[model samples]
Target: MKEITMPQTVRGVVAMAKGAPVTLENIVIPDPGPGEAVVAVQACGVCHTDLHYREGGINDEYPFLLGHEAAGVVESVGEGVTDVAPGDYVILNWRAVCGSCRACERGRPWYCFATHNATQKMTLEDGTELSPALGIGAFADKTLVAAGQCTKVDPAASPAAAGLLGCGVMAGLGAAINTGNVGRGDSVAVIGCGGVGAAAVAGARLAGAAKIIAIDLDPRKLEWATDLGATHTIDASTTDVVEAVQALTGGFGADVVIDAVGRPETWKQAFYARDLAGTVVLVGVPTPDMTLELPLIDVFGRGGSLKSSWYGDCLPSRDFPMLIDLYLQGRLDLDAFVTETIGIDGVEAAFARMHDGDVLRSVVTL
Candidate 1:
């Protein structure tokens, strides 16, 4: 592998501190060093995690470069990099699996504990070190990441749409297809019809689920869920979620219940809303302060699998290209996830829209 010869300076969105506004600042990106790559980001999506980082929900890492879901063209690759090259169109993924990790040795590379990022750092113009969000800070003109973080995809695909596969969309789709293993004719219920939940509905439909139920407090989200293949919709604001789900499933509950709203209430709803022996997949992320409590007997009596999906249990190398193909073939509507596209400076506004459920995703186009 050879290191790229040129380093460049670019503008990027930076969260200078917790609870402060993110600003556009000049960033100095160093040439790709061993096993790294430099990507000229075409588009990147604003995700809740980025907001979380900004709000200090993730960590105290200040002056953080925020944005992860992105698609870009590789500008150069560093020494020992063979998987991708300059000019290759790729989606950036946070998990860069290390084959030597224990999980990888067991053939579950998606659970790799030793994921890698660029050995080098992108710095503020004044030489302050910057933490790249999720190891793939992409809300910028260009970003540096591990070579393995760049998953090659069809260049013809819309960057705004394809970039989403790098995170939230992929997580939602994987929660249904990978973690839940939704099968044809299965009845599925998804609580919280946000981006991830809506994607779960689409994934369940793609997997041939017979009854796809979407539950959300917002009517608009339910509508989005319907467009994404939900056969039934339940407005939690006006209805009993578990009861509505059971009613839709002939009083037996669904075959699989996905809780995409990580909360004690929603988790309880999902736990009780699944039929006996039905699976419960928790794909929504919870804050550290959150805790769940259930009857010990209920846990044993359920006799079903309770699982948590990390990034939808997705193997980006296998899922990205396949999903891209589906999108290109008109089978998957990836474009539906992109509600708007904005310039890098609009990330803060996008964050507000995301919080208000005004958009599924607001992509930053470079």
Candidate 2:
């Protein structure tokens, strides 16, 4: 049995107010309660979602404890928790699906309506309650999360790389393989060559896409897409994106078009940049004020599916370990995503670099 102990103090990044910069402050993590576990986080990726949380894009949850994409080792487990035990290497995920939820009951836990988080809350040293980002705040030495949130993976896998499977990478891969249902020899086009976009390209490759077209405004990101298995690239800034995609696919466009940009204009391009009956997957995060005014006639004329991917429509327990195995087997280049690694203190600057389109990921190593 795992021995329970007193609350522990650790420093974590916090966003105190909307649009304000983040700061490192001492946080008090209580022992895991029923069905919860404590993790000694090894590495956590800095995702744009964290930036959004800091900017008040997700919600008005103030003094938010940021950081989610993470890999760690189980340090303790609470009463009745049995999925993971001490010393287990694990990836932390937000979707700790409740087994009896509607989606779970329907055998589609991926769309779980009721996900679990730590039953107990971690707070500032001053005792102010903190809302953890995505329920697995991990930009610290330790974090408390629901036991189901931790998916055991290959201990040999690099925590920095395996941790990526927790969020953006999984979302992108799941967007292509799970949501988009990309099949062998399919022609695919992905817009926006950011972390999610690049991962989408990799997913397309892993799904055996014969001709992958990557579209982005930045030359650097386009180059990244090419390296990630895109067979062709389109400079959306200087080209008619839809026309270019059509030309690449014998004037019929790709079979699957992914909009990782999440903007109205890019989404419109994806809508028209696919063949009739083709699919369009939107994996990008869009602002609330953003709106799309599309012709109703086109919806009837297009004759295809338009879907938005949340967390890539993924099931962490099913996907994380398998992806990590692929990574360890040299089939998936998870390392390609880690552009740089930094200390916890380097997060703010890393955010700037991410905003500037400088890197795919900056991992925070403890």
Candidate 3:
């Protein structure tokens, strides 16, 4: 355990009400409790999940401290903590799996049911409790989290690029490499070309897939996808996605079709755009209001795995540092994902630009 010298309060972005603008407020961060650590955030990426929290799309939890994709230095650790210490550079992960959970017992910690967060709540100046989004809440100068959430990485890596591995980018990459099991000479098709989708395309390329097809309605997003490593691009606004994918794959469809959009229509497209016995990886998060209506016969006929990727089925401790190394080695272009870096004050504006389809990520560098 390390000695704690945490501040009584720090400036943080907070969502006070549903569908309302988030504001910077003084948040009281308590000293780390047992199994917890305090992190001095260096960089945090603005993700769709944060915007979802603001719009009440995730839940009714108000006064939310929103920001998850992050990289930082360890400021302190609490009692019984030894895996990390002060001054260690790390990437923050949302899933800090509990070792005693069923999934962990079975050696699948990525699916662990008991992910943890700091026992102490971060509060506003008025003592109002703020729910840290995804239990990370890194849109601040510092944040408290479970010690396991912090995955140590090389200090030489750019914080802006490394932080992205904490969420969207990791999910996208894992959707293809981990869930899709993309391999050399395989034909992979990714639906949606947002941050997650673009990373999936990159992941497919990294995994040595022979042909990568990127599908998106936005031409700019498609271009970004190509930059990431899509061998082919489909303009969904004017073309039939399934047909285009099939056409590119010689009428057999792709070996792995990833649905990064999570919409019912996109999921259906992914479902039908894979070859017989091909994998369908659903990495995009779908809202509760959305429903799927697939024929039972098709489910049997597909004869392949239909898997939903939770955080891209990534094990943070294993993936973060490895991906950072790949980025440093020039094999993975993590810098391409960082569209811009802004101060904490620019978060609200970043949220607006996110919808414009021009930016891949707006990182907040503290």
Candidate 4:
């Protein structure tokens, strides 16, 4: 293929300082080297992690390219790459499991031995090196990442919807299917009706959960929860979540209670919202400063698993395509999660909306 004149700078949202606004500007993107692939991003969702990066919760890496939930088409491939090719519609995965670690050695390659990431550095127009969030940053028209990070999915699905499986949706689904092991006729309660919480509701429903109680303070999100398959909704602002869940589930409790909010209060609710010998799945990512205080006897008395889900135990190669297939079959309502779409320049404003719980997901389309 004849190489055209590559633009020396590509437009991106850059966080140059902590607790500052992200500014869109021309950034210098180097040619793909080694196992890297330059992806032409179609859509990237504004996640809490992006806001955390701006607030320095992730790291002190200034000039960070903030975004991870994304779907894109591969524009170019680098040396020794074969997993994906140019023109493939792919969802980016942060944990591109390395296949030789202790976890992988046990035949669980989903827990990879070593994960792949971008090998080349993307920089600013002024020659400052920019750290791409999670090594697969997609908050730009184009971003570079390891070929392993790309999981090709059904091209017909909307990018804004498909991209969500790259993060929050995957986390929530994984918590239910992967961690909680929610089964048919099982009763499940989710303590939070945000994107992840609602996703858990959907996943549990898909997994054959009979009674799914959606708990949240906001009425808008409760409506969204109902739309996404929550059989019942609990306004935590009006009633106690644990008591409400117990009342609904035969006066015992749900079989599984997932703490999508991840705070001490919500976690406590999850602990008491489940029946004895039931599961408690924590999918919410908590801040570093937050601490939990629970009785040790309760831990032993529960007689069930207390687990945390990471990225929904997502194996991109396995889960992404399967979820996309489900979406195409009309079984999974991935489209319902996309509340609105915006351009790259709208990411900062999208962050404000996310903070206010105004939308399920604000996707940035290039």
Candidate 5:
């Protein structure tokens, strides 16, 4: 017989109502059962996804527990959990692919149809179930997740920088290196130069892109993209995005164009911004109500790949530690993405800054 661990109470941020502000409340976390683990979250980045949850842009699920991009230490593990153990420094990832899924069995775990999350519920003190954002509610003192969601990374890395890779950063990097298949001397262009777009630019540079063109309406974000590795920038607010990209690429457009904004307009821009047979990778997150319509003839005329990147099609088990190593070696500038650090209570103000595009990432340090 095994001893049953009592439920522990911790402070967490919750969106109690749609279109309402998030509140700090007490929540109860159950003992990890069978394949779950509890993580004492050290640093959780305030991502745009968390803001979407508050605005009900993701779904109608209210009282949502937010925060996902995170890094922490494994505090405890449930029985039969062998992937990670206590005292291990880890980065929390939402994709915990089940081996039995068709996608996983096809040797494509990145597109795993079935992902695992904690079976046990982490509820409010009143016993109301709180839906965790992306199945990871790290905006708390602690969080419970399926053991597979915990990806162990180099402990020497800064939690604030390493945590961003848990989501946005990974999405951008994978968009270029994985989905886009950016090759040496390729001309790459990334649209919407926010955190994700900037990361895509860096990823392109890392992959030996000859020309990295960044397009965005905001000069601040464009400047950030330049710092990250963009060799050229297009101010979409004034200049024609497609024309500028073509001009930068010797009038042929880029070899690969990535849209990190996730809007129909930006996607269309990406669609038309690439050279013949070039690839377009849509890494940005689009809202539910948004619809995209393109001419059927144009779809055929454009002889290239149009793909959507979910979490940059990343496998945390493989990418996390390797990227962390690159960061430690100074080959990858993970630290540049972090704009500021704040306490958990400062999330709302951080959200305001994120809304105004005043910050890249306002990390919540526990």
Candidate 6:
């Protein structure tokens, strides 16, 4: 085999300043240093987080390369990288567990103490430093990341579909499976029918939820939710969501209520939509300024746990392969989530479509 030399400069979208539109420009992607890997990005999804980062919702890190949810083939590896090799297809994970954190010491490497990222800076064509989004910027044809951040998966699956499992899909699925512990015969209600919420509906169905109620303002999203295994749909724009969910669940409320929208109003709805001893899982990301005001008595009154799920409390090493296998077997409907396939240059337009709520996901195919 010939030694492959990656392009010295690759086209990537960067947010040069906060609250500004992302500009596609030539960026310098360096070779993998120690414990690093360069991935030949095959596909990356445009997520709300990238938009948030662009608007300075994430941090003051300007000149940021924006993208995280991605799937690709490992192009090269640095010294001491033994976990993956060139030619291996992979799904990028933000939570690259360190396995030596306090959480890991307690046998929970899922909450790694010291997750790693690329030590090298991928710069602009003019040699200005560029901060890769989430440390695995896949907006470019190629990106650099820590070796552990890339989890190998089945190459037979489409990169457009498999890349989604890297973020929102995994977050939603894990919220139901790992955080909510949705089980056979459980009555589940998902507030918000976006990609993550719809995946929660699917996850609940996969876990054998007897009645999966989908709530959303958009009828189209609800329809998509139904296709993803929602047993019932509630049009929040026309009806009271909590009451609608209660009526569907024999008036006792659902056994598991997942607040996937993250707003205080929706969180309250999720709080009130579940039966006693039922779990309430908050998988949605709320803005920092948003505050929740609930009765302390209600907190004690609720017998079950009220939990917040981070990235669906997922373990990338374990979930990625299993989900890929499920996708391959046609047991999980990953394809339904892909409403459109686009090129890297289509990211900005995809973001606009997302705001319009017209598509489930517009994946960027590199």
The lDDT of each candidate is: 0.94, 0.94, 0.94, 0.89, 0.93, 0.90
lDDT of 5 at 142: 96
Model 1, residue 62: displacement in angstroms? 0.8
lDDT measured at residue 157 in model 2 versus the true structure, 0 to 100:
94
Error of 3 at 169 (Å): 0.3
Q: Model 2: per-residue lDDT, tens digit, 276-296? A: 999999999888889999899
Q: How would you encode candidate 5's per-residue C-alpha lDDT over 1-366 as one tens digit per residue?
A: 113378899999999998888899999989889999999999999999999999988888778999999999998899998889899999999999898988999899999988999998899999999899999999999999999999999899999999999899999999999999999999999999888999999999999999999899999998999999999889999998988888888888889999999899999999998999999999998877899999999889979999999888999999999999999999999999999999999999999999999988999999
Higher-scoring candidate on TM-score, 2 or 4? 2
The sequence of per-residue lDDT tens digits that candidate 3 reaches over residues 1-366 is 667665468989999999889999999989988999999999999999999999998889798999999999999999998889999999999888888999999999989899988898889989999999999999999999999999999999999999999999999999999989999999999999999999999999999999999999999999999999999999999999999999999999999999999999999999999999999999999998899999999999879889999998999988998999999999999999999999999999999999777699999999
> Worst ten-residue run, lDDT, model 5?
1-10
Q: TM-scores across all candidates?
A: 0.99, 0.99, 0.98, 0.97, 0.98, 0.97
> Against the correct fold, how does model 2 do in TM-score?
0.99
Please, what are the lDDT tens digits per residue for candidate 1 over residues 1-366? 443566689999999999999999999999998899999999999999999999999889798999999999999888889999999999999888999989999999988888999999999989999999999999999999999999999999999999999999999999999999999999999999889999999999999999999999999999999999999999899999888888888898999999999998999999999999999999999888899899999989978989999998998899999999999999999999999999999999999999999999999999
Candidate 6 global lDDT: 0.90
Model 6 agreement with the true structure over 174-282: per-residue lDDT tens digits: 9999999999999999999899999999899889989999999999999999999998999998999888888998888999999999999999999999998889999
RMSD of 2: 0.8
